[model samples]
Target: MPEAPEADLAGFVRAHDPDRFLCTLFAPAAARPALFALTAFNHELARAREAASNPIAAQIRLQWWRDAVEEAAAGRPARRHEVATPLATAIGAGLLDPAALLAMIEAREAETEEDGLETEQDFVAWLRGTSGGWSAAAGRALGADPEAAEVLRALGAAYGLAGVLRSVPAHAARGRCLLPRDRLAATGLSAESVVATPHAPTVGALAAEMAAEGLEALRGARRDIPRGAVAAALPAVLAARDLMRLAAGREVPAPRGIGDRLAVTLAGLRGRV
Candidate 1:
C-alpha cells in the first residue's frame, strides 16, 4: 500500500516542493525515513532562496545556506539549522551525498544572483547545470548506474530547458528573461518587445518550439528510468512540463494555481502507477 504523506518528514518535504516530492517513488519503505528527512532538509535550505521576500534577505539567507552546506562538508555541524540534524542523520544512514547536497545549495546560490542570461546557449547551460544538476542528484539517490546517470542527466537537462521555455512569459513579466537575447534577436524580438507584447504569434511559436525540444529530450530519456516505484513518477514529470506549456500559452506571471495543478498531476501519477 502507498504510505501516508505524513509518514516521517514526507509532509515536510512536500512543503518545499509538492511537485518534486513525487520523485521519491523508488525509495524503499525502509529508506523513507532517511529519504524524507534528507529531502525535507534540502527543501528547507532551498526555501531560503525561493521564499526570500527581498533581494537583500534572499542573499543573506542563501549565504547562510551556503555556509551550512560548507560546514556540513567540513564535518562541522551547525545547531541553528533544523534541517541539518535530520540531514546529518540521513548522512549517517548512507542516505545522503554531501557533494550532491552542496551542489544543490550552489545552484540556489546562483539562482539568487541576477546573472544576465544573454543568449539561448547561456540559458540552456544554466538550466542544465542547475535544475538539471538536481536531476543528476536524484539519479544518484536511485542507485543509478553510469549509463542510467548519463540518461538521467540528459533528461534533467531537457526538463531544465523545458522549464525555462515554459517560464518565458512568467520570467518576462518579472523583468527576467530565461531565453537568450541572441535568439530573441534572431526572431526580431527584443527582450523589451517580449514583455510589452499583447501576445505575439511569433513569441508563442518560439515558446512552443522550445517546449517541443524539451519534450523530445524527455521522451528520449524515458526508457532510461527503471520500472517499479521509480517509474511511478514519470507521469508527474510529464504533467509538470505540460503545465509549463499551459502557463506559456497564458503568459501568466505565476504559472498555474497549485491546488488545481496538484489534483491533475497527482491523478495522472496515480493512474500511471
Candidate 2:
C-alpha cells in the first residue's frame, strides 16, 4: 500500500488552524485525512497575501497553486509541497473537486486586490466564495445530501465574517481592513481610523455591528442544516461564540481553553457545531 500522506500536514493544520483541526476530529476516521488536507489547503490560501511582500508576488503564489490544481485534474504528477501532495491524494480519492478548489484559489486572489471591503454585499460575496466554499466542500466530502449545501454556505459565511472581524487589529497593522467601508464611513470612521484606534468606542461599535451580521447568518445556518451535515459545520459554533463575546464588549476570545474545549466537544457529540 502507498505510504500515508505525511502526518506533517495535519500537524501544520493543528498548529495554525486549531479550531478546524478540532472539528476534523469529529469527522469519521475515513474522512479525517481529506478534511485535514482540505483545511490545510485553505490555510495556505488564506495566508498567501500576508506571506508576500507585494501584490504581484501574492498573485504568483496563488497562480502556482492554481496550476497545481489544474495539473492534478489532468492526471499529472502531484507537486512535492507539504499541503499540495496530500491535496492531490484527496483529489485522487475522489474526495474533493478540482473545480471547487480552483474557485477557492480565485477567491483568495480577488481578496489580494482589495485594500478593504467597500460594501456589505461585497463582504458577503467574498465570504460566500471563500469560507462558504470550504464548508460546502467539507459537506460534499462527508457525503452530505445535496440539499445541505446552502446551509453549509450560510454557516461558513457567518464563521468567515466573525474571523475577519476578530482579525481587525492584525489586518489593520498590515494596512488592510476587512470591515465594510461604507458602514464605517456612515459612523464617521474609516479604515485608517480603525487601525489608528482599534480600541476606541467607535471601532468597538463597528465591531459589534459586524458581529451582529454574523449572528444573523448563524441563525439561518442553524435553521437549515440537516443532522448529517452538522459535524461538517462545527466551526460555526466557534464563530458564534466569538461574535457573542465581541457583542458583549469583550476582545475576541482566544483559542479553546479547558472549559471551552469541553463545550465544543459536547456540542460536537450532539451534532450541533
lDDT of each: 0.58, 0.81
lDDT of 2 by residue, 77-97 (tens): 888888888888899889988
Which run of 10 residues does model 1 get worst, by summed lDDT? 227-236
Q: What's the lDDT for candidate 2?
A: 0.81
Measured against the true structure, the TM-scores of the candidates, in listed sequence, are: 0.71, 0.93
